[model samples]
Target: MRTGRTAHLLFLADATSVHTQRWVGAMAARGWRCTVVSRLPHEVPGAEVIALGTGEGNAQWLAAAPRVRSLAHRLRPDVVHGHYITSYGFWAAACGVQPLVLTGWGSDILVSPRESRLVRLLTGWTLRRARLITADSRDMLTEIATYAPRARLEQVYWGADTDKFHPVAKAPWPFRIVSLRAWEPNYHIDVIVEAVALLRQAEPGAAIELHLLGGGSMEAPLRSLVRARGLEPFVHFHGKVDEDRMAALVNQASVSVSVPASDATSVSLLESMASGLPVVVSDLPANRQWVDAAGGFVVPAGQPAPLADALKALLREPRLAEQMGRRNRATVERQASRRSQMDRMDVLYRQVLGWTP
Candidate 1:
């Protein structure tokens, strides 16, 4: 594969999403003339943006098809890529875009299709329309297979920026546990709060703190749980922070925890690994694809006791935590660094375009 090849890519996605922004930026940097056609327009340098401005609903998507078709005809991009198969993928299919590429973002494939018969059938139809489909994890790829076996599937991770997330000079601080997972229903962040309380009970007078890094529908209830457990002093709710602050927080933290009920390859977990923090992740197949005993402990999800025990062990054994962090850094450098993954993605793009390898 070579760099600096001229290519045009039209992307359909929720431009407001950070993931979308990151993907667009990376793709643009690789010398692609990227144009983002999104419902909600977001600013990303080096790429053209087109806002659909259509209000949400099935009716809106149907209405927007002609507009999308007109735009596609005008641009005539080499490839049409859509993120989140549920919405963008369907839109791309509806617009009759050729050389279509669809990327499934976790719940869109795992949860949304099960909501209704129409959605399941429509999702399968959309999958059949795509020339290539991508998933962030092998588990997700398998799920996508159940819907579209004939659709070409590739497991491509949205990996972490290792240079920005690399280990920093460690300063003496309280044993800090950081979770970048959203405080949402499936994420079970409240379970982490409960785990903290259990840790307090198990270790009589351990100096520890928990940093909840994202906000969601479960924020109020999780805060209430923290208060009820009298964990105000030890738990901190940091709604959300920018990328720099996120890197700093992860670098400072002694351990990271991510126990989502279902997930793909989480950028949070990869960032923690690149930042040289020991992780305690859920034993979900998606998470297991990246995290193992070598990087961190894989505890059973939704179980506070086992979760706390994992956190406690990391807290108790500083050497073990440091050892695991070192291993994690090495693993990420080899497998999940942003540059390497993006290079592989570029190869995929070229392959799809039938460019000579």
Candidate 2:
């Protein structure tokens, strides 16, 4: 009976990130009022974006907390939600809002805490401040438990819009591969390029095309590596794209590759799966939760030869790839559909505010 009243959510998150956009967009579509406070430049359709700081480094992030609390005081939102445990999470905590919600994106809980004792303590401070906390993976939840032993928590997938990402009729024998991760060192984009070089050698007769989506500081180095490996004609860099464009490119491919050095459940990986494309991913504990032999191949991170070998196997067997794609789609429908995850979030919001019809 959530028909009459509306919940207004104030979020502190990356305005440019598609993940943040999905959260705000979904809630907005449900007729809830949404406002985002971000340092970055971008828009989440249907939600208001409040720019903070100069859109730069760590100092700006740290300096914005007091201002954030002031904003919270004025906004008086029904829920104050923070996306990213180490940064905005701190601000959400400082605001002293009732029913504060914090979501620990992968690196914050796993990588950042190990940076130093100060970071570890700060992370704990944010976790302890929130009435409800969410993470996309079990390992993330386990790490959250370490920081705030008694914190209430939930597993919430960023998830894929199944309709947008679902398989499209394509050239049955298409020899295209797509990588949607950022061109960052941790993501091992170079390894994917090197593996593609190996894959080219393994399948010299076939016309293999590798498409790299998204961008970062590693772009110049990755392009140089592609040139050095003589894969210029085969690998295409499309930079960052909108959801519609991302879905189009993903559907145009025969398979997807995402071998990051570390990760939680990736929205890109889930989107690729929904598009009915077999994936070759890293052997991370989080990846193991989603990809398996029936769905995709998992290889050691930063190892080109093994990754290339996995890619080669998929390249040779279109039928096997197609079968794997089906398995992946089924898995996503059962576990990572965006609509379902949004429903879970809706329930979480109600529980947090004690809302009823």
Candidate 3:
């Protein structure tokens, strides 16, 4: 049993994000009291949810700030943690909440900063209020340092649950590839389709299948691209699957691909690794940390030729793919296990609260 002074946490984040739900659940399981304050209503097992009912877009957050602040005063949490620096961090800081912890989730720091001067100023100002800031990757920490130079920053991964994502035995059939990233412009899901088209010619008469497992704005256009390339029979779009079904799909595939243009350490990528599948991912600095030469091929984002080559190579050499999958499983167990990362976060909570073992 967990024995310690309980830490009451007030989390500000998007209720829709799987990252937020997972983190809150993990902390609650560890005996921390977690209350989520979100604009969107979500059900996190073991935590109390205060649905702010703030609608879509950034402007809505301004209206929701007063409610958030009022709730904070009444609750008097031991710590206030904001998941996305640009959105939740803005509100947490605006409310003048102290002992705040802010986590930068990739695009919030990388893409949002470039939106406008006001946004950049607001993000930096909020970072200043944070007692500590957390980011998923070392490269992300380097980026956060520019915005909040004096603020303490820690690299903490929102890790994949190893127990839930571990590999299951299955006899392989035709070569199958899974891309679970959303069909958004940023994730470049279209690139996966294009790469599959290129691979068809590289390995003539070879039976191959591409499983696209997400939903986004680019769905219609991605379908058009697949039809245009005459890849309708070869590709299957399984839109926005849940956890259990997604794990079943991953276990059935021989390879996985997540070549987003930019990302922090992806939970999907970690799950793919934990499932003992070799991945073909973008060569971005963040991905480079988890996917090395031993685990899989790293291709340049948006380049079909290299991605096609990587995919074709894996299909041709099944033994090589298996070896990489084994390496990936071991690597994820060592570096990205959810149990280990959550344990680390628990330590940080104690340290922040000045509670000794």
For model 1, residues 189-247, the per-residue Cα lDDT tens digits are 98899999999899867788999997889888898999999999899899788888899
> In model 3, where do residues sit more than 4 Å from their true spots?
1-6
Question: What's model 3's TM-score?
Answer: 0.95
The alpha-carbon lDDT assigned to residue 179 of candidate 1 equals 95
Per-candidate count of clashing residue pairs (backbone under 3 Å): 0, 0, 0
Model 1, which residues run further than 4 Å from truth? 1-6, 57-59
- lDDT of candidate 2 over 191-289, digit per residue (tens): 999999998888888889999999888999998999999999999999999899999999889999999988999999999999999999999989999
Q: Write the per-residue lDDT of candidate 3 for residues 108-127, one digit (tens) a residue.
A: 88888888787788888888
lDDT, model 2: 0.89
Q: Residue 117 deviation, candidate 1, in Å?
A: 1.3
Clashes of 1: 0
In candidate 3, clashing pairs total 0
Best by lDDT: 2
Worst 10 residues of 3 by lDDT: 1-10
Task: Candidate 2: give the clashing pairs.
Answer: none
TM, every model:
0.94, 0.96, 0.95
Taken over the whole model, the C-alpha lDDT of each candidate is 0.87, 0.89, 0.87
